[model samples]
Target chain A: MTATAPQALATLPLADDALILSHRLGEWAGHAPVLEEEMALANIALDLLGQARALYAGLAEVLGGEDEIAFLREERAFRNCQLVEQPNGDFAHTMVRQLFFSAYQQPLYARLSPVLPLAAKAASETAYHRDHAEQWTLRLGDGTEESHARTQRAADALWRYTGELFQPVEGLDVAWQELAEEWHADIRDVFGRAGLTVPEGPSEGAWSAGAGRQGLHTEPFGRLLAEMQHLHRSHPGATW
Target chain B: MVTGSAPAGRHPREASLTQLAGSVPDPELPVITLAELGVLRRVAEPEPGHVRVELTPTYTGCPAIEAMAADIERVLREEGGAERVEVRTVLSPPWSSDDISEEGRRKLAEHGVAPPRAGARRAGPVLVGLSPTRHTHPAQAPAPEPVRCPNCGSAATELLSRFSSTACKALRRCTDCREPFDHFKEV
Candidate 1:
């Protein structure tokens, strides 16, 4: 059966989320703090890129070709959440950002697994991503005082962007409030074990910051998109 | 597991289509055929001279799948003499290393990647280092299984990293041989 518009619309944000984050993670390839981390980040980036490809291919049935949908889109036309578009600051910041996002993704995918076949497969991969983030969260949070402080700062800085994760998106079957609660509980538990406190303040409400699902993004996304689209845009219709 | 067998009165062309599609080698793991890897889920023909093949990816993001799909179409048209070919990817009941055929496992080990131990599915949340959130029921937590070294045939190996060159493999170091090898990780 042909794809419906709502199905395409429902998947666009998720596709953008994976695509943008994949590019961000790929930026750490040669520059990660350690060799193992370099491989780890690349592997995760590749996984996200794969998810984006499948989502875009599915979208192509309703939208257009995958390459055009990915590389040809204007910055204002993108649908990625601001959380994913944020610059990966430092190793601590990257890990905290990863933890927050993966924590939300794992549960979100789990809930969607039964209804969405792609989500079921992605849920398996996201479980590993969550575990990787959780493991690092513990290591950085419980290490030396300097490491703990750095991670704490990163967590606090990124916490505000997470409100967008649980905001209800059209054509998705997830219970937004339930997902937010599960994500909050999981993060709180991990933080408590690491001797770090969940940063105080509202996570989601009328004042929470985000509108990415409507194709709005933060400032850094334009620069990131430019860098990502440069080669493809320059060599239009070129193939290796 | 659609075998290349024609029913009593069925067209021989349909069976050939299944055989041709099943014979396509995985682009990434060339040693094993798609049929051996359990990725070739089904092969059928809606009408004569038109073939449709279904495949599942070993990992959600395996980059080789598009290439593999293209290869299937090429092989079917060039070798199997099909006029029309379509490759569909299905994700439900998602692939596991356990889906690897015994022959596939043997080939993988020969290629220096240790295949997953039989019947082991990755389960439960992986606890981080020094965390108090250990699994409450001891029975539910299986003891860590020893990964036999593909190079030395020794079971004395340690996991170096969960991530490797590809999503489906883990880097492991053999204690006995001092050789690092890839373990075809169970998803």
Candidate 2:
């Protein structure tokens, strides 16, 4: 392996995070609350999938083919954050999840933008995603008592997994503390405006209950992987 | 590297090949040529009769890229009389709405998709805090510039949705004519 091999390996989890989330969001096609929303979610899913493809393609030289890495990998071999792999529970849950993840992604991409051109492009896309999630969070949180309660619950439930997003990856050069702080401040501000409270708990520190960077995942990930890989695995060497 | 092929001795046919490849219309937005859309990054002949074209997708997951690449290759081989065509996708210096040529913008407006507003590039520090923090300060997002209605040419419009039919557009409604239209969102 070349010296840059580890750097390519580091990108796998980031790519997987996007890939899995794209699949989850894609599941909402034709199932979103409205036609516009359906289009919106699918568009977002497509963007994530695009980012994943680019990242995977960048690693092609080091990791063989992008398809082989994305489709053929076993559950234990896949690297992705637990947050993205969590099931999309409801509209509220999905929106909350999107808000948290996009908020983290926006800043993370911004920091990486200088060194990685893909990050610059992904940063722009993530800006829209973060805005979409924040808008929904506000609408849902302040709209109705039922909506507010549901979104609030979703926010609280998903907070734990967010810490993992701030964890340092091997190749990425980021100030984890600053990223975590910015993420926290952004989430707090959005939640505050939406009439929701930021869930206070253990900060995203060394002791966080996540090893997704090391290939460990939550319970729901295996099923998600199965569905994602089923078609690709079944039709090996198939061309469209 | 072939020693015979020198930079100063580039074949005259190479320029025509570049022009031919660049003239291919984007599969999705037929109104704009690949050159206008800035998707056609570079066209070169590494050796005689072998064309290499580089392209960047407008959006990360734009499905049209495969078709666009195929179209480029087909055109070069069948029409341009090239022996081989290679199309590459480059992500660095990622494509921006700003990359849309003046002609592309005009064509997009003519086609009823509002082109991105000039000088509306999303650059600068994004302030995420509602309250001032040590690293950042409270700042509201910049308001979107007025997108003139592609149909009626009215600036009175309201954003209905941040996303539209395609990944590159946002849904907006013209207040004057009451027509919902697509605004080519600034990336």
Candidate 3:
């Protein structure tokens, strides 16, 4: 709680991204294959929640209240990109989603670190996150026949949603092109080694796909929001 | 009670308060004091008897931060005789694993936990080895040298898991001694 730094409307999307992804990862609590894996996902989720809280704390002045911004807002009000809100389809699906998001987020944070304190603080954490995702992708894609097929399928299904990440937000000064290039190159390198190929669909989220940045999310996002907001909505002003 | 006799009038008090606050044991790694861990950023008597403590978290989501803050406040009030104690969290100059002092590192090793290697972390995306990555470590901090086991100082160690009992630690096992220990991850 450093004196609430005057926040930008731009911080909203970034915060929402972290918060939503955290909830999605949290859904793996008891269901992850092993105990250590369960811990890893939960730890990563905690890190995302921390990043979201830091961003939201900055926005408390403009956004009214932190809990309300998270729990009370409608689906249209949220600005997280479509990729994060997509449900954790399977183990491979979860890893690929993490890979795409963390790859984008790490470099973006590196670029933003100079002007934004949160970004600088989180850059290293995001790097670790990318590492985690990359490792999982490499293993799942190169492992057994079933593992490779499942991993490839997950990558193809999720490829379209990734385009929304590059869409620039207001007030944040960043080289969106450079960030996207870095992400694409890195993802290609990882995928190439993992025996996977880039899907042929339009990577540019045009008008029909991956429009969560404009508050137009996929079908799964609404259900996610419902589950996420239920507790706070059920008991207003609830204290943990 | 012994004032002015010290090197500086205010320094002795601040130093004493700093040591007092730093003496609070870390909730997770009780082997090291907060001072040794290097997280107690400041201890200032803003007004007479009213102490303000500035602390930072090792990791943003570290759950131990609350316990650390509470311990700091309690020790300062009960021992330092401060009328009002306020422990505030500051995130500006975020805490780093490098902040853990030499003595703290020593204590961690003594307690069978590997201390985080300073300056081992590089600044950039890690190039993890391709297909069937053996080690599976995020190449971010490829310890310049192998993480020496605290129990036996064996260079042949394996990383078991990235996240361990706590967020800041990673589990590793020593090849020689066959003892599994927690290596403090360099952030």
Best candidate according to lDDT? 3
Which portions of model 2 show Cα errors greater than 4 Å?
A1-6, A203-208, B1-12, B122-140
Per-candidate local distance difference test? 0.80, 0.80, 0.81
Instruction: Give the Å error, residue B95, model 2.
Output: 1.3
Candidate 2's displacement at residue A71, Å, is 1.8
Candidate 3: pairs in clash: none
DockQ for all models: 0.46, 0.39, 0.39
Chain A TM-score of each candidate structure, as shown: 0.94, 0.94, 0.95
Residues B1-187, candidate 3: write the lDDT tens digits.
1111233655677778877888898999899888788788888887878999988888777788889988988898899988899988777666778788888999999999998877634533222322221243435444455678999998787777777787788777787898889988777
Clashes of each: 0, 0, 0
Per-residue lDDT, model 2, residue A200, is 78
Taking all chains together, each candidate's TM-score versus the true structure is: 0.89, 0.90, 0.91
The deviation in Å at residue B97 for candidate 3 is 1.2
Clashing pairs in 1: none
Best by DockQ: 1
Q: Is the docking of candidate 1 incorrect, acceptable, medium or high quality?
A: acceptable
Model 1 alpha-carbon drift over 4 Å, by segment: A1-8, A205-208, B2-12, B120-144
Error of 1 at B63 (Å): 1.2
Decide which is better by DockQ, 1 or 2. Answer: 1
